[model samples]
Every structure is written in structure tokens, then in C-alpha cells.
Target: MLDILIKQVKVLDGTGNPGFIADVGVVKGKIQEVGFITRKAKLVIDGNGLCVSPGFIDPHAHDEGCPFFDEAVLNKLSQGVTTDISGNCGQSLAPVSERYWKENQSVHALINPPECMHEFTSFGKFLDAVEKKKIGVNMGFLVGHAALRIAVMGLENREPSLAELEQMKVYLRESLEQGALGLSAGLLYPPGSIAKQDEFVELCKVIKEKNAIFTIHIRDEGDYVIESVKEAIEIAKRSGAFVNISHHKAIGKKNWGKVNTTLKMIEEANQDGLNVGFDQYPYNANCTYLNTILPPSYLVREREQLVMNLRESQFRERVKEDILACREKWDNFVVNVGFAGMLVIKADKTPDAVGKTVSEYANALQKDPFDTALDLLVDNHLDVIAVYFSMSDDDVETVMKNPYGMVGTDGIYMKNKEKTHPRVSASFPRVLGRYVREKKVLQLEEAIRKMTSLPAQRLHLKNKGLIKEDFDADLVVFNANTIMDNADFIVDSYAPNTGIRYVIVAGEVALKDNLYTHAASGQVIRRKEF
Candidate 1:
């Protein structure tokens, strides 16, 4: 008898292989059989002719901020995600310190900020805590450059001294040695904005020495997108770093077709024997703090100085002038598309502001959209999250079809039904439902591979991406015909998908019929360092 037997399912082995009917046996937390199985089991689940594939791996997730806040990561589990790669866009959860608490108060408080941010001091300690806590899904991480930079030096906008740079390298090397799979840089974010190309190459050198990957939120996704791509590729080439671009997108209407040029550049880089890839969520919109729209120069000062500048009329006039004089040449998305592109999804102190666009709020207040945005940021102390309806469906699909492209939420793990981007709950299933099933943009097998093996390979997880006999029994069984995402804008963003029948983490059932079993069976996925 087996621990569990899932019988008569169409198995998509997650290798981009055609689906075939098979029975799978699970025992002692790993797949014991993958073909013909006649033995009885302690528990048997008739798959009801559903499709079983390896559990999806989300390559970009911000849930690492405080995994426990997600309450079993129900949103992700319902969508078939079993492993999440966090520590993205220059923000990670570990190597915590008081300065991190101060610098990130607004960002942290916005998402159910964890009370224990200061407890964990190193990557290893953080992973240990995660294991002890027993989170709901597997986790992998990249030590973020922004966090490390702050840890070593305050959020100053200047080149690191030779000693300071070496200290940063030491911290990164320690993180990689202690199970971090890679290094990530949010070059567009403050503190990260100070990183010059020479600095990136130097950091990538440390990452390359450990044979780990380097993932970057490139400096610009709008006007300077092409140049940013060239710089990212250059860092990879010069440092011998295996790099992945995070949440790839072209953010403005004018830049709608730029991904074509970016993809070609990445392809040619691969041809030159360099490893490069990108991940994208299937939404035409993006979510980030409202302060991100401000010039990085304005944020380079101390926190007190930043607050003073926001209140000063002269500074406001300067910002207003820049906003109006904006050419598409700047990285500020507000200037690129104007304030109308920003839609407030969550504003805790001002709950009434949720579900409204900046333009709408501005019009209601009879103020310029720029001033309304600035006032809100000042009132909230820069703690606001919004969605940018900046990308085109055509551009999103074009990037999605690329062979090197994998899926990532670039989304937060929301615990509420508050107006959040639907990608939070529906990204993977949306791909299956809207893109794969309805639109036929990609075959079912191909889409599964992108969500599974492609991300596993990128993270260097040898055992987690496929449904082989000896692999861990992390799997999802769902109805192909009925399977589709039900989440949408605002209220329905919390709605679960329609077809996920069962989710298995380590051979035990975690979700049966889209309801979480509250099983803390997840493990911290660490790098296999030599």
C-alpha cells in the first residue's frame, strides 16, 4: 500500500512533454511511482480525469516580506504555486537591522508587516526561522543588493569606498554560501540608484564566483529601457553571471513594442554563450509604491530631508515643472504616462481612496493630478501602493511567448479582499484560463513548462521541477476543461481559481478542492553550493 495514490490522471510531466494518462504513487514525501500502479493506498484520490503536473514555481514573489502574514499563502496555493522565489527588486526579508526598519517602515507597514523583522540577522538564520515556522510552500531567495547596501552603509547616494565595497561583497558571499541561490538588484530604487555599471559588474563578480545567478530589476523599463537592457547584459557578460531579468515589461504606450528589441538582445546574448532569461506576469498593469514615481534624486537625502522636501513649496514647484516638461526620456513613469496611469489599490489610512485612479481622486479634489499624488504621499508618509495600467496586451503577450520567459507575480501576497491587482491571486491560472485555454497563445504543455521546469532550472533546483519517480511529490491536479482564474480587479481579486482540485506538498495533501488544509509542509529551498 502506498501513502497516497492519485489514479487515472493526464500527467503533464513538466518537461514541455505531451500529456499522457498515468497513475502516480506517493510515499514518504516523494513520488514513488509515475506509470502503471496497481497497489492500494492508505488514501486514494481518483483524479477524476484531471491533469496533474509538477507544482508551479513562482520566480518572482514579494511574499517573503513576512511569509506568515499570507496565512498559508492561500492565494498562491489555490493557483497551484508550490515554490516561491522572493527577495526581489532590491528588497529582501533578511539581514535585518534597525536602519532597515526605519528605511522600510512605509513599505513594510503597507503589507501586514511582520513584528519580528529585527530577529533574523543573516540569510541562514532567516531560513532556519522559516523552517521552524513551517510555512505553507517551498521558498527560495536572492539576497537583495538594496538591503545589503543599507546594512553596510546608510541609504546614501554615493559610490562605496573600497572598504565599503569589499564589506558588501563579504556580506553577499556569506549569503550565497549560506543557501541564497542568487543576488538581486533593484537598480531603479533609491540606494540602488547609486549603483553605477562598474558597481554592478563588481557585485556580479562576487555572484559569478559562487556560480549563482544574478537577477536585476533593470534601471528603466520605459525611455531608457533599451540602454538599461544593454547595461544588464553587459554586467552578465563581463562578470560571467547567469542573469535573469525580473518582471520584464515595457511600461508606457510609446514603449509598447520595445520588448521585441529586448528579447532579440537576450536571444543573441544566449547565442554568445551567456545565460540570460526574463519572467513576466500576464497583467497589463503593475503595482508599486507611489513614491517610486518620484525622481530618485529627490529620495537620495535623509528621511528628514525627504519629508521636508515633500512639504516645501519650492520643491513642489520644481517637481511640477519636471512633470510638465517631461519628455519620454526619463525613468519616472508618472512623467512617461502622466498621473492618470496610476490607480490606487490600497491606502490603509485612507481606505476611501482604494479602487480609484489618481486622476479620479485629483478631479474629485479639484487639484492637479500631480499635486493630488504628492499630497497623498505626504499625508501617508510615502506609504501607498497602486497599480499602473501602463503595458499593452499585445506587448504582454509578445513577451509571454518567448522561450526564455517564465511566470512570476511581481505581486504581493494579499490576505484581504481589498482592491489589489488580480495577479496576486490569479496569475498562474489566468495564464491557463485566458492565455492558454481561451486564446491558445501557448499550448498547455508549454505553459506548464514555463511555470515549472523553467523556473526550477533558473533557481538551480535539480529535484523540484518535474514529475519523475524520485522527485519530491510537489504536484497539482486540476481540471483542464474547467480550470480558469476567477480573480479580477477590485473585489474579485481575492476570488480563487475554478479548477485546482488538489495540491500536494511533500506527498501530503495541502489543498483539496481549492481549500487549504493548513499543512505547514513547506521547506526552505537553498542553493547547492560546492
Candidate 2:
């Protein structure tokens, strides 16, 4: 007898193949059988003409801290995500350094979550704590370079000393040995920005030696984006590391079609057999901390010191100039897209500012948008979160059409927020409904494959992201005709996807009939060590 059985379902198989009518059986938390199923089960679900595909895997995310919170990834599960790759953008929960531990509260509130950090001194210990949380979806991790820097250098802007370099390599090797899939670098962000090209090449060499992957968020997405891409490609080529470019986009209106050239470069790299590709969100807008709009140097200090730096007249003038430039200079998204393109989505002590742009707020205050943004940063002490309307929908569609491109929410764990980007709750379903069903950009099977096998292969999860026998019984059952993402950008951001009847993570139903069953049965997936 099986643990649970689904009868008369159209199976998509998650291999980019055509669908076939079949029955699936699950037992002992694994997929037991597919095709004709005449066996008995403890629980039976009639698919009612729904499609059953392997669970969707998110290739880029920062939900590593979800385990500490009570909500525990309800937003991701609601979107049919059964697994996600977290510790993205050069941030991880494990391998905490003594300096980072002390400065964590003031320096990085986003990455440090729970009292669990004290119990773990290494990557293995952190994964142990994550397993104890039993989150709603399987999670794979990538050790972050910023975390290592904080542990060793404590936010310094200089290159590591020889000893410091060796220490970071040891940390990376240890984490990879303990099941970290790869190394993630956010060079545009602090701590990681301190690393030079030679530094990155050395770290990539370590990753390559361990038979792991290297994922990077480039130093710039506008203005100097091509130079940034060259830096990343050079690191990969020199070290022979498998590379994944995270959230690949050409920001700014002039840079709208730049992804065309970037994608060509990626293809050329692959043709030369350097193993390079990118993952992207399917939305026209982007989300990040408001402090990013400030000059990178102004953000290097601690919270209060950083605020003081922002208050300096000279720094403020530099910021104004950077935000108004339109050439190959500093990477400023606000200047490139214009202030009208930016809207605040999250901030401190400013609930009314949530849905309005800096320009709108500027007009109301009778100031320029640059001054408006500066005042908000000072008022909120650089804790604001905003959305940037930077990318073109055509570019988003074009990137998705690439055979090497895969889907990722880049969304994190959040619930019951007053205002948020629709991508947080709508990425997977939006792809199915808008891109696949409505626009015919991709076949349903091809879309499912991107969400499944491709990401699994990228992360090297042998037992996940497929519907084959003996695979984990993580699955999604949804109606193709009626399935759609209801979350909107201006309003109703928390609206769940429509036509998803059930979501199974490891043979247990996490979402059934539009409600959580409180059956969180997920595990932390680790890479195979050399």
C-alpha cells in the first residue's frame, strides 16, 4: 500500500515533454510509482483533470532566515515552490565570525536571524539548526563571500592579506565539505565590493577545486555593466568554475536592449565550453534596499556612521552628481531610469510612503527627487526598501526565451506586508499564465522544465526536481486553464495564485485547498563533497 495516491492526473513529468494521463503513487516520502496504478493508499486525491508536475525550484533567493520566523516560507509554498536556493547575494546564516557576530545587530539585520547563530560556529552547524526548523520547502545553500569577509576583515575595503586570503579559502573549503553547493558573490554590495579581481579568481579557484559552483551578482548592472560582466567571465575562465549570473538585467532605459549583447556573450562563453548562464525574474521592475541609490563609499561604515556619511555635504553633492549622470560611470539605477521610475515599497516610520515614488514625494515636498531620496534616507537612517522600474518587458521576455535561462523569484520570506512587489508572490504562476498560457512564449512543458530539472541540475540536487521513481515526492497539482497569479504591483500584492489545488513537499501536503496544513516537512539539501 502507498502512503498517498493520485488518480487520473495529466502528468507533465517536468522534463519538457508532452503530458500523459497517469496515476502517481507515493510511499515512505518518495515517489513510488507512475503510470497505471491499481494499488490502495491511505489517502486518495482525484486530480479532476489537473496537471501534476515536479515541484518548482527557485534558483535565486535569500530566504535562509525563513526557518527562524514563524511564517516559515508560506509565500513560496503558495506559489508552488517546493525547493529554493538561498544564501544568495553574498549572505549566509552559517560560518559566523566573531566580528560579524558582534556587529551583526547594527551592520546586517537582514542576514542575521534568530538566536540560532550562537549555536553554530561552522556551515555544518548552521545546516543542523535549519533542519530543526522543518521549513515548508526543501532548501539548498551557497556559502557567501561577504560572510567570510565579515568573519575575517570586518567590512574593510582593502584586499585581503596573504594570511587573510588563506583563511577565507579554508572557510570556503570547509563549507563546501559540509554540503554548501557553491560560493555566491555580491560584488555590488558591501564587504564583497572590497574584493578585487585577483581575489575573486582565487576564491573561484577554491570553488573549482571542490567540484562546486560559483554564482555572482555583478559589480554593476548599468553604465559599467559590460566591464562587470568581463570581470565575472575572467574569474570563471581563469579558475574553471561553473558560473551562474544572478538576476541578469540591463538597467536604465538606454541599457534596455543590452541584455541582447550580454546573452550573446554568454552563448559565446558556452560555445567555448566555459559553462556560463544566467537566471532572471519575469517582471519589468526590480526591488532592493534604498541605500543602494547612495554612493557605494557612503555605505561602508556602520549604521550610525553610514548615516553621518550621508549627511556630509561633500558626499551628498557626489550622490546628486552620480544620480544625474548618463555615461560609463558609477552604476546608479536612479539616474539611469529617472526618479519617476522608482517607488518605495518598504521603509521605517513611513507607512504612507509605501506605494509612492521619490518623485511624487519630492513634488509634495517641493524638492528635487534626489533631495527627496536623501531626506528619506536620513529620516529612515538608510533602512528604506524601494522598487525600480528599470527593465523592459521585451527584455524580460527575450531572456526567458533563452534555452540556458531558468526562472527564479529572487523573492524572500515575507507575509502580511502592507506593500510588496508582485514578484514575491507571483513569479512561478505568472510564468505559467502570462508567458506560457497567454503569450505562448514557451510551452507549458518547457516552462515546467525550466522550473524543475534545469535548476536541479544547476544546483546538483540528484534526488530533487524530477518526477522519476525514488525521487522525493515533492509535487504540484494545478489547473492549466484557470491557473494565474493574482498579485498586482500597485495593489493586492498578497493575492495568492489561482487554480493551485495542492502542493506536496516530501509526500506531505503543505498547501491544500488554498490553506496551509501545518505539515512542514522540508530538509536542507547539501552538495556532494569531493
Q: Write the per-residue lDDT of candidate 2 for residues 54-166, one digit (tens) a residue.
A: 99999898877777775358778888999978888887876777666655334446543677575556989988888878688888899888877777777777889999999
Kindly report which residue pairs in candidate 2 clash with one another.
none
Root-mean-square deviation of candidate 1: 1.8
What shift in Å separates residue 342 of candidate 2 from its native position after superposition? 0.9
Candidate 1, residues 1-530, lDDT tens digits: the string is 79999889999999998999989999998998988899999989897579999999998887775466554777678889998888888777666566554565333444454666676568788777677665788888888887678777767678999898898888789888889888888887777877888887888999888888888999889888999888889998999999899899888888889999999999999999998999999999888878877776666776566767889889998877765666323367786666787889877776667788899888888988887888888877777888888888998899989999998888776555567788877899999988999998899999999999998887888788899988989999999888888887766677878999999998888998888888878888888875
The per-model lDDT (C-alpha) reads 0.83, 0.83
| TM-score for candidate 1 | 0.96
Q: In model 2, which regions exceed 4 Å deviation?
A: 104-107, 312-314, 325-330, 415-418
How far residue 159's Cα lies from its native spot in candidate 1, in Å, is 0.7
